[model samples]
Target chain A: MKHFIVGPVETYKEVQNIYKQPYLYFRSNEFGEFVKETLNRLSSLIGNNDKNSLLYLTMSGTGAMEATIENCVTPKDKVLVINGGTFGQRFCELLKFHNIPFDSINLKWNESLTKEHLEYYENKGYTTLFVNLHETSTGQLYDVKLLSEFTKRNNMFFIVDAISTFLADTYDMSKYNIDVTIISSQKGLCLSPGLSFVSLSKRIIDKIYKTTPSSLYFDFKDYLKNIERGQTPYTPAVFIMYELKAILDLIDNSGGLEKWLSNIKEKCQYFREQICKIGLNIPTTYNLSNTMTPVICDTVNANELVKYLRDHYEICVNPCGGNRANYMFRVSHIGNTTKKDIDILIDKIQKTIEVLAKRN
Target chain B: MKHFIVGPVETYKEVQNIYKQPYLYFRSNEFGEFVKETLNRLSSLIGNNDKNSLLYLTMSGTGAMEATIENCVTPKDKVLVINGGTFGQRFCELLKFHNIPFDSINLKWNESLTKEHLEYYENKGYTTLFVNLHETSTGQLYDVKLLSEFTKRNNMFFIVDAISTFLADTYDMSKYNIDVTIISSQKGLCLSPGLSFVSLSKRIIDKIYKTTPSSLYFDFKDYLKNIERGQTPYTPAVFIMYELKAILDLIDNSGGLEKWLSNIKEKCQYFREQICKIGLNIPTTYNLSNTMTPVICDTVNANELVKYLRDHYEICVNPCGGNRANYMFRVSHIGNTTKKDIDILIDKIQKTIEVLAKRN
Candidate 1:
């Protein structure tokens, strides 16, 4: 089967190749160098300053986001979260769970973050801003520069969940002045889905060490302290770390990050064009992430379309959950997906849509 | 490299074979059935009643312990934790982190939990007891029957972190009336290290639903709601779940759970016998879990011996941490370890000690 799903993304052959070998003991100096090297490569890829420290957490993207919040934000800080999709809402939910007071910019599912959304929060004593660079739920790519400029002006510590957008889009944490950036393994990294990580600036690192974490496992201090010897406080997803290094090696060897992002953008554009030729269209009302296109399945039931592709052609795409299940599904271009794979999926989707439309 | 580490153990060729394939997406109906079947197999293996519900978490074992506490225990309960080793101390640490007031039965580094230890808390109205079936750090296995009887008479909820001992030891959760059993993937399951699971009783499930979790990612309510259809609330370690089923299949096909446990026992006995021939002995003052044996290395520095074995022999074992680093190490028989593998490790370790002793 072909993977077009947003994540647990289609892992490349070379990336998953790391798992066929023996599991590395994390405390070994050999494994320590491997872990440190991977973190260094990730740091270089993100183009962050020396002050930015990397933490590899064995959790989902949501867990990493919670860790980011627990480490960086407290009740003393008034936080502003942009809620345009499920993930953004997750930040708000976590904030509420932590009993931290926060305001949110709630947007429609199809809406994008704009300069106007940040206007009201300016000079309102908001100390932090939380956003998802690409809201995968609704396929909206928030303008990073717009939000960065706003956070810079308002003196808000910017936090971005770059789960779906890291390598698939142009993101320079240094350029954006982001204090914290969260990422997962399966999305842009094209690894398995268990590992997630966050990069924190020196300013937040000091703040994090001062604060006692609500959860012991989510504590950044332990992870940061252990990284000095290239270890985690607990047993990590050691096999997944192998996958991370392998993927980083592949990216470094194959024309680096720029070519990787461009390839995803090109495939995304190509998939959109092919789907459009067969009367399918993207209905989201905003600029999109290169990772996935939110396709409108109005001619055929979206769930039916997803099943048809999955069952008949062995292609899988995002079956939009909740209300959107009837009309919207996502076609992802990230994670080992190529133009050929996209062409096959689009060709199959084109025929499957016709069959389902006629049945309806 | 051969693995004898307490965890990230030597994964057999068969278990590692699962990683050669693609990563599965957790949202599929097929994945749901696969996950449900794995949980069912685990439940049967644990011999728990239908009142038990299983949760698969993409986290380290410590994360599972934290999740168990968040769901099953609250601040109102007067808790008693057994602190015999590092893993036991973790439970105390988590309880302290959650602001749950608890008393601990602090044992010496090599001490075991005995009837005398439980005698003090007998009539104190303690509502719960936390334990690690096998304290991995010191290779001390607590007597489940003794603890079970004490908790049964006192009417306390019993939570066991059976991360290292599950498949290696003959444990019957139902027979012991265990309220919750927390396990990790890399240990007795013999899979990758990223996934952890907890089996909670019906009583605790209802209690979990009523209480608000301290962290959003750890909210058992959301995990429980999603598991209705064999899904986690967030993206799980999809590939690891596949590995879970693969290993479960291997166990089922090859002599079932009983045989698997027996084999581990045989291997542990063989390793201990072989090590005794080399003048090394089990040092801990307790019954041992078939999982691993804490070895006293008084003739050679523990860390130095560990490095020598790893660098020259390619055999990995637990290099005892903290103060025990000079004289203690542990050799595990969990995961993909076998009798033949143990013999090889013993032979190499014996010869390596002579070389190290001469150099010293």
Candidate 2:
């Protein structure tokens, strides 16, 4: 009943406070101004060096990804997808659904993309490079700057799925040369899920014009047209937009993006130290995500451990899925989560594991 | 500065009360149960006889329409679109964007699709009939029962864009053999515009599996796959969903669907009578939509009248768009609209027209 699942995580009280105001339907000018302010705040957060970068807010992170592909890829256009975890695999699936031609470079679950991988794809003449900055499935963070540079050298469009990274990670669009960076409200923004945002550079916008026309609801061009008036082509989630505005204000007041990212890193480090003391191995040797920690157990059943903690200690954690289910479990330190929350989770997991190990 | 635009007219204080509840994310079982109960109540209101007529909600009415098309129409299949107003034109545009082969019968703004028009499309061998029950732009309501019969007789599918007509208008899916119906939370449902609902019969579900996989975000299969567990495929707008539950409960407590429809009809009659006294002409002789009345002014500028009323009387009404903008304006009686609201609008419009006539 209690959600420990990775996002739509707990929303901040300030985000909750905005929803209390009277609802303005999406068509209202009040909603329009809210959207405009949210975009302006996002641009500021991302450091608005690229005046040409347009932000399109959508229903979810997946909606943003769908918009990116639907707008950027035409039929038969060859795109290179870098797959390491579930989110990366989703990009390939999206490509397949659109019937766009794609070649994927599959990496191990916790592996980061090396420059060699990008160069190989570039040499193969892939027009776009699709990579996840932080793969939620494996708690791996790739160096997007390195990958962006490699793609730039080949004149390829660098599409980064930064859904799990974004505000919590230091990403300079100007430095990375990211053509399209996708993010969502739930992950690093400390808001509830339901909104997704994509910052598109001019180069990417030009490519979208040449791409095959997509469905009306997901049409990036249609969204862009409405963006001028601070409106979406359809009715957007107005309450979520309000929440986004409040969260953006909070971030601005909290020393902006740098302070937010440092706070996440600090919490992640604290959780990692606790995990080490508890004798649990981290699933990934590569860079871990600031949002969550995936730990591997030597002899404990990860699913059982998750359930025992939740049932007995009233603490929640996510049991790993797919091939990682038996040996791995994940604890999210994202959104409004704090050290106290992490301590409660770790303490519960430690006690639960000890009791379960003795019974076994 | 004030929103006098049609439905989403103004969210009720009761609806705002629901939204103000501390923001619980949708992943919680409490929120999930609320959504499930909301759907159940809506099903009863709209006369969904089949237990299998699944109700799936989306971010907006346009999102629901996009999902319907993505699920029902394959690229290889030909669809028949009935374009009578702005929403109908939108459906045609969606078909174009999706690259689905569609033949459209464009009717005049106030004209309703007759049996002859249906036979013409049927003879042309189209497999689907798309109708907008209440054309929001022109204020005309189609007899969906007749159109559904035509589709059934021709062995084709019937999909209705009932966005503005669902609860306010009478519709019996079983009697009419309607395959799919789409409606939104705003318009006739008297809720905010953030949510859109679609009810599908078994026949449409069968066809969706055969359709080429189009979009990931609005995919029906993904929704269906998750709805059994009372979950959406993505993170939904939790606060809005809570509002929907409150709205549906109010609908049930207010004597259910029959009483709701009668109330709409009575409101329309009163509005029409008042408009006639003000010397305005009801342009559409066909059954006027229960939700709104479109009035034509031979001498007064519709836009000017809208501005005068809003600026002077603090009253809001919709100025007709497209070809009708100069000659006509609309007043909606949909969603949480009371007789007092109608009286206020009518009084303001009469006074505004009198002042404008002197200036002319």
Candidate 3:
């Protein structure tokens, strides 16, 4: 089966094989060295400076986002969340759960944030901005350059959830001055789903030390202190950490992040070109992410298309939730997906469209 | 290496082999059924009622403890924590982080909770009580019968962290009137360390639905709804769930928990009797857990004993943290441990004690 459900993406065999070995704990020197090397590799791939502290949490992507809020965001920091989709709204949810005061620039499901939208928050004394760089729920990538410029102009700390966009899109924590960047193992990393990585700048690290977080499990201060010895405050999803190292090595061995990003970009462009030629409508035209394409189905219901693909060809594509469940479905370009695979998917989708026209 | 750390203990070969397969997601009916079956198997193993809700979180044991506090313990409920060791104190820390007021029955490192201790807190208007049934850190298994009687007399909601002693000891949530039971994969389950299980009674589930939780990631409400379809709100550590099913099958095939407990109890008794004959002190002798035995080192330092075993024989044992680091080390009888393995560990410890003189 071709798994393209946006996460728990296809992984390399070597990474999975690492799990065959019995559990490795910090007591073993080999596990300790593996953790330190993986931390270094992941930090390098994200282009973060040495001054920053990077932690791989043992939970999902949402856990990392909440950890960022617990450690970095305080009541004193008035936050502005760019609410575009599910992932964007998650930041607001986390902040609300922690009882932190914040306002959201709520946008329509397919709407992208523009300079005009950010201008309204400027000079409003907001000390922080939260965003999901690639809103995976809708496959819309916001302009980091615009967000960075606005944040720099206002001297606001910027936090980005790059869970789906870290390797699929170009991301440099140093370049964007991103105070905190959150990522997970299942999407671009193409590993298991439990491990989530949080990269914190020196500024964020300082703020973490100065305050008590709302959570004991998701505290970054404890994680940061433990990472010095190449361990987490609690036991982590260690196999995913090994898989993360394997994937990082794969990227580093095949040139670097530059080459990896370009390979994904080429496949993404090829997929988009073939889908358009076959007459499929991608809903959001502006600021599309290379991670996935959100296709709008008019005559053919998106729900049926997804079910048809799964039932007949043993293929899985991500379907939208809520009101757009039957209207839009997503085809991923991340993970170990290839041009040939994308071509086959497009052909299958075309065949699916013809067979399901009368049913829709 | 002969793995013997309290957490991430030695697992069966079949369970480890499950990890070799590629990742499984809820999209597959096989995985969905597997999770549903595992949830049922685990709930049954804990002897939870049919109306109780079970959630397997993709996190460590501490995460589940915090989730119990977040969902079940509201500010309206006055709480009491039985502080015995590191794990018991952890419950206190989690409650404090949420700003919920709770007093603790503080005991010495190896002190056991007794009936006289409970008399002081009796009728104090405490609505809930939290306890680590087996304090894995100090190898003291509290008498749950005594705790249950107290909580019942006081009409308090009883929450227990049965992480290290779930299968090793006799536990019936219904029999004890336990409102919540917390367990993790790495301890008695003998699986990987990422997944944590929380079993909530119908009453606790009703309490969870009444108020907003302090955490979004650890919210029981989202998890409870997703569990209806055999899923988590976020993606979980899938392979562990699969391994959990494999373990449950193994336990059922081997004549259920009663037989499993006898096997562990046999090995635990054999180990203690041998250590006593060999002139070693098994500390906290009054109420020790079948899961592990904490040894008190008088002549030979506990730190030296642990290091010598690891360096000389490639054997790992659970060492105490904080002030007891040099005075005590633990030998575990849980997680695929055999009587022969126990014999080997004891022999190694005896040899290490002879080899390292004046180390203390």
The per-residue C-alpha lDDT of model 2 at residue B86 equals 83
Q: Which RMSD values do the candidates have, in order? A: 1.6, 3.3, 2.5
Off by over 4 Å in 1: B22-24
lDDT of 3 by residue, A197-281 (tens): 8998888788889977766887787888878778777877766777787888788888988999899899888888898899888
Off by over 4 Å in 3: A22-24, A27-33, A358-360, B22-24, B27-34, B358-360
Lowest-sum lDDT 10-residue window in model 2 chain A: A19-28
Best by lDDT: 1
Instruction: Provide the lDDT at A176 for model 3.
Output: 90
Q: Please, what are the lDDT tens digits per residue for candidate 1 over residues A1-360?
A: 788888878877787667676555678888888788779889888877562289899999888988888888888889999898788888888998887889999999877677877888889888889998888889898998898898899888999999998888888998989988899999989888899988988777878989876788999999999887778998899888888888988987889888888888889888888888888788656989888989987878999988888878888888887899999999889877778887788789888988997897
lDDT tens digits, residue span B24-114, model 1:
4568897887788778888788777572288888899999999888878888999999898888898998998898889999999877678
Candidate 1 — which pairs collide? none
As for DockQ, the candidate ahead, 2 or 3, is: 3
Best by DockQ: 1
Across A1-360, the per-residue lDDT of candidate 2 in tens digits comes to 233456766667788676445454355465577677668778766645454355655477787888789888877577988788888899999898888899898988766667776666656667888888888888888887688777878778888888887776787776788888888777777665566778888878877767654666777777777887788777666566777778878977889777888998898899899998989988656887777788998678887887777667656677777767878988777667778877877787788889889988
lDDT of 1 at A261: 80
In model 3, what lDDT does residue A52 have?
29
TM-score order, best first, reads 1, 3, 2
Model 2 C-alpha lDDT per residue in residues B1-360, reported as the tens digit of each score: 233355665655677675335444354465567666667667666667555356556467888887888888877778988888788998998888777899888888877668777666656677888888888888888877778777877788888888887776787766787788888766776565566778888888777766655677877877876666668876665556777777666766779767868987898889899889878899756777677888898778888887787668766678887767778988877655677877788888888888998999
What is the TM-score of candidate 2? 0.89
